[model samples]
Target: MSGLTVRHPHPSDHAALQGALTDWWGGMGGEAGAQQRRLLVPRLFLQHFAGTSLLVEEPEPAGTRGGAALRAFLIGFLSQTDPDTAYIHFVGVHPEAQRGGLGSALYQRFFDLVREHGRSRVRSITSPVNRNSIAYHTRMGFRIEAGDRTEDGVEVHTDYDGPGLDRVSFVREL
Candidate 1:
């Protein structure tokens, strides 16, 4: 993490982040990954909530002609309706950079940002099918919120996004 730089995302980052999501998430393959890609970071988040979002990258190789290489990102915002709460909409870590504490650093940075703004808690959601995400969040000290229903023994919010689009919810206190 020494060489990596953390900065607020700009509108220019949307396309590149989208590409990273596609590449990092490509393991799902076929329609599943495609569907997730559509729900990944949208332009409006970077445009409106850049202050609270973060982009992590390492400098391009010395001989390279491009910008830094994307390593990870977290898109989050303090809730307008619940001033004491912040919501993390999406997060991604380059596959090659996994297990190096990059994801934890992003979350820690976001927690500090929100806490500075008076937020006492943070919330996020993930598909129950993403067992890795669920496990990761749990390991990060997030408590899974009890939902209306359970699937595969995991609590989930039925129709959280819409009919049949269930999600597992997580909340962590700052």
Candidate 2:
């Protein structure tokens, strides 16, 4: 983490990010993980929202041709429908980097960046089954928005992603 730097993602990063996504998600090696990874971070985000996204990478030695390790990343953007709101579309932290504050740092940086752009609130969502995500978001000061349905005692937006894909929506007021 010492030499890691945050910068805007490039189109070329899509492959590396995709290659390591499953591992970052704790080796999601089954069909479910495969399906999720396919839709996770597309090249369009890097191409269109590079300015709004952040990529944390550990640069290779001066002489190396490539091989920078992707430590973490956050894809966020100011809301077009809601002038004062911003949305964190996606985020991923290398498994080894979890609990080391990398995720929080990414979120904090996004918050600061959005605030500078006149955003007063930030929103995000996670699957109901991801208890760690639910806990992490709350610990990061995001409050779960009450939904019309509840799953496993936690309120969730039913079919937020699609049929049977419930999501826990969160929002934080800055």
Candidate 3:
């Protein structure tokens, strides 16, 4: 989108990024709102996975943005538990920048980096209620894992996150 450039996220970017997600409650239920999720995200993710995570920006005065700015970001990493797979921890695009391909670009960038590192697959999980995330992951070539079932219109993986917080897990071959 708009010739965006990509790079690792700096520590200072966390607050702004978190703030940007303040209203991004789509798909997530009230129990897992943006604000609630923010508390669970440690700052270390930005510091430790800087190389694998990425920040996407639009050049100054480009597109609808008035100046060079962060358009989207991806917080992902090679899985520590599974060496052959990478995990996309988080990904967000400013509402204004969405639908402009910025999110796709960030995903493509992650796929390339992980593939270079010998990763043969990628995985991610989202709340069952977050339909937007499920669709987006599917669009990125991730498929729902087995055992997931639709309940009351929500495709769920029972107890995926905890006893009650069912989640949708996605997997994609790299």
Candidate ordering by TM-score (highest first): 1, 2, 3
Candidate number with the higher TM-score (1 or 3): 1
lDDT of 2 by residue, 12-113 (tens): 999877866666676554767865875778899889888889999987778888778888989888888999999998888888788999989999999999
Which candidate gets the maximum lDDT versus the true structure? 1
Q: Which candidate is the best by TM-score?
A: 1
In candidate 2, stretches whose alpha carbon ends up further than 4 angstroms from where it belongs are 61-66
Give the residue spans of candidate 1 off by over 4 A.
29-32
Clashing residue pairs in candidate 3 (N, C-alpha, C atoms within 3 angstroms): 27-129, 27-130
Q: Which digits, one per residue and each the tens of the lDDT, describe model 3 over residues 6-85?
A: 88887888886776566554545454576677865568888899999998877776456575576788899888888899
Worst 10 residues of 2 by lDDT: 20-29
The estimated TM-scores of all candidates read 0.95, 0.92, 0.84
* Deviation from native of the Cα of residue 41 in model 2, angstroms: 1.2
Q: Give each prediction's root-mean-square deviation over alpha carbons.
A: 1.3, 1.7, 3.3
Judged by lDDT against the true structure, how good is candidate 2?
0.87
